[model samples]
Target: MEAWKEKFVSWFATSGRMNRAAFVKRFFGVNLVCMAAVLVIGSRVIEETGSVFASNLVSGVLAALAAVFLYSPMVRRLHDIGRDARLAQAYLCFGIPQGFLLGKVAALPPGSLGLYAFEAALAAVTLLFIVLVFHAGEPRRNAYGAVPGRAAAAQQTGRKKGRRLKKAGTV
Candidate 1:
């Protein structure tokens, strides 16, 4: 438990480097926080004034902007863990269709077990994909640049060398 806590702290403190578990945990935590905020504030606003559309629109826009801004850092963190940014694109590939299917199911006849089965399968597959992303192999140096932890160490060494040179008036 201590080790796990240390890993979380390290991942959060480091600029981009994070292990897969840490990355997944952080991603899920962010999503949960966003969902909670939307649920609480949106529910209050709607209950007080009965404007479901407005509340939904506001929450949707907020979530979209958060996703857009958070994506790059998330990608960078994935790179640090040795995964490709394309892995993050799984949501576009699988999640969108699943969401559409869900909507279709909701609109179907009341006694449709078929849609429920399909939805369950889709949910399982989505969960599997999330696990796969977290379990994917790490790269040595991905397109995001060198591995962050190593790069930081190298930078520190360079700075130390520069300082020594300066002290010797040979820089």
Candidate 2:
């Protein structure tokens, strides 16, 4: 239980590299949960309130919370992919409108200029995110932190051994 708490904290509270496999697993897992929540809880709120403002409000709040929760991991994943971490900001830029427009997207006219722009931006960011999930992370230590997984353990063990040797003046 303690170990799991530490792992969760490391992923959510810090900006550090996250390899492709871990990123895909975590990202998709969170998305699935959030989507389910939105569908269930948001719908419940709408059903109770029977108002557009209430539904939109719930969606917007959930979207913002999801974005905030995902920010660190998303940035870390981008770092692992050798991309600028700030790319995560694009998620924030699109998230609100995506939430607010969730129901209205279907009604948007095909030729609406704003709709095209929003769709294009959303598509581009989504494509980039997919590529990040599939692309292998850097194999060695990077600016963000040590390599993850087994390679990281090996690197860290070697470093610890070196440090011990240096401390004993046996290098």
Candidate 3:
């Protein structure tokens, strides 16, 4: 139970390492939460209200919060794989806005260059994140703290004791 808490909460931190399992799990979990929020709030409430500003406000607030929560975990996940966290800036700064732009462009005449461009960009960004989330992180710690699976246990005990416990097959 405690492990689960730590794993999920790691989404809010940008300076740690996260193994593939934790990254994949949180990736899906965050998507589910975002979908639920949009369905419940965006579709049901905002649409029914029929106010464009209200809808934008609600959705924008939700999107911003989601980005805030997702940004750190994404950076850390990149770090775990021995990559610069700055790589995530592309997705955070451009990919997400491009997604919204894609939707609007969809209403434009078919075969619009802008629509195709946005679609291509969004696809590339999604693929990048998919690959990153599934890729195995550096086996031993590189520079971004220890391997997360081991780091959590090590954090619970003194480093020496943690090493001993790992050797004893208890951690």
Candidate 4:
């Protein structure tokens, strides 16, 4: 738990050195929280007044904003995992269209089996890209500097530990 907190705080602070597992866990965690909030809030709004359009619109807008805020951090996390930020663009290219189609299918009256099928297919494709991003190759010396492993080792060894000077230009 402490490690998780540390990772979260560090990512918040510097957006640095997240491994594959960490990146996915954090990404999924954030998305899950956002999704759950949307579901709950949207359901409440619809149940209270039965305005599907309004509820859906609000949910969509919130989700889009959340995604906008999340994308940069996620890309940075991917960078920490040694992957290119361009991989993040995959969702924009593929997932958005699929999601739009799914939204349309969901809005259908009934007999929307095709929509569900399409949704399943989209989910599979999205998962595939996510897996690809998680398993993407890490560069040795990225623009962010050496990988986390080396930095952690250096921190542990005290070799690169920073120290305060005792007297101005002396020591």
Candidate 5:
């Protein structure tokens, strides 16, 4: 229980760098969970209550809760790439509202221009985020923290320097 507490607390702490693997796990894992929850729990709520608004309310709450876990990991990924955490805030400012708008527009008749536009915008934003997560990260320490396994790269650099010095008879 204590270990779980620490893990949960760390989820929101955006102070350290995270590698590609950790970033994918936390970000995609939470997103998958949230999607599953909305699909499963939300459908059940609607079926039982017979109110789509209530179902949407439940889904929104779940998404907001999931966002609590998502924002920090995104910030950590930005740190790993030597970028500012504030970049993640754009999702909070725009993405959430866009999501709501998307849902509303999704109900429109097929071939609606607004639906396609919103979908394209959402896809573009999602693609940008996907590229960020998958982009190769800096493998050394930065303002946030050292990436795991990056120390070996630094050691290899040091060894190369030592070899050069030896060849030049400086050491």
Candidate 6:
């Protein structure tokens, strides 16, 4: 648990490198947790207020916060791959507009063009996110920082050896 907290803190830090393994692990794990929270809280909000809008309001705020947690890691991951972090701007370009438009289109009747447009924009943003998450990081360190996997492995191995030596009454 303490290690997870430390990892989460680093995930939000801007000055670091994140390899593909780190990115994928954080992305999937964090997203699954966020999704579950949204489902539970959004449903409860809707049930309490009898308003889908109320639920959306609560969930949208939560989602936005989750996106912040996601964004820093993505930027670092791109940095690890020798790509500029600014590439994330493309996601914002599509995502921001889609976010606002989605709420408006939610009340639209079925088969509405506005809804279709929203879907299209959402699809594009999702695709970009998928590509970034799956893209391989540089095999060696680039300008950004050291490779995360190697550093983490070394750290873990050292900790394990220390624990063994401690148990043997050797510091």
What is candidate 6's lDDT per residue for 39-139, written digit by digit as tens?
Answer: 99989998888998887776676666666667777788778878887766666555434433556787899898877877887787677677777777777
Clashing pairs in 3: none
User: How far does residue 119 in candidate 3 sit from its true spot (Å)?
Assistant: 0.8
Lowest-sum lDDT 10-residue window in model 3: 94-103
Tens-digit lDDT string for candidate 2 (1-171): 999999778867546688777777877877888888888987898788888678777777777777777777788888886777667878777765577776676578888887788788879878877888778888877887777776678878999999999999999
What value of lDDT does candidate 1 attain over all alpha carbons? 0.61
What are the candidates' C-alpha RMSDs? Answer: 8.2, 3.8, 5.4, 6.4, 6.5, 5.3
TM-score-better candidate, 1 vs 4: 4
Provide backbone clash counts, one per model: 1, 0, 0, 0, 0, 0
Check candidate 1 and list the clashing pairs: 82-139
When summed lDDT is taken over every stretch of 10 residues in candidate 6, the lowest stretch is: 93-102
Pick out the ten consecutive residues of candidate 5 with the lowest summed lDDT: 94-103
Candidate 1: tens digits of C-alpha lDDT, residues 1-171: 999999656543424555556456666776787778788888888998899666766576556644543455455565665566675554444433442354356568866887677767668646744664555435576655676467789899999999999999997
Any runs in candidate 1 off by more than 4 Å, and if so which?
A: 1-26, 51-59, 77-85, 93-125, 136-139, 168-171
Q: Pick the winner on lDDT between candidates 5 and 6.
A: 5
lDDT of 4: 0.62
Poorest stretch of ten by lDDT in candidate 4:
159-168
TM-score for each of the candidates: 0.56, 0.78, 0.74, 0.60, 0.74, 0.72
Give the true-structure RMSD of model 4: 6.4
Number of colliding residue pairs in model 2: 0
| Alpha-carbon local distance difference test for all models | 0.61, 0.77, 0.74, 0.62, 0.79, 0.75
* RMSD of candidate 3 to true structure, Å: 5.4
Which residue pairs collide in model 2, if any?
Answer: none
Which candidate's TM-score is highest?
2
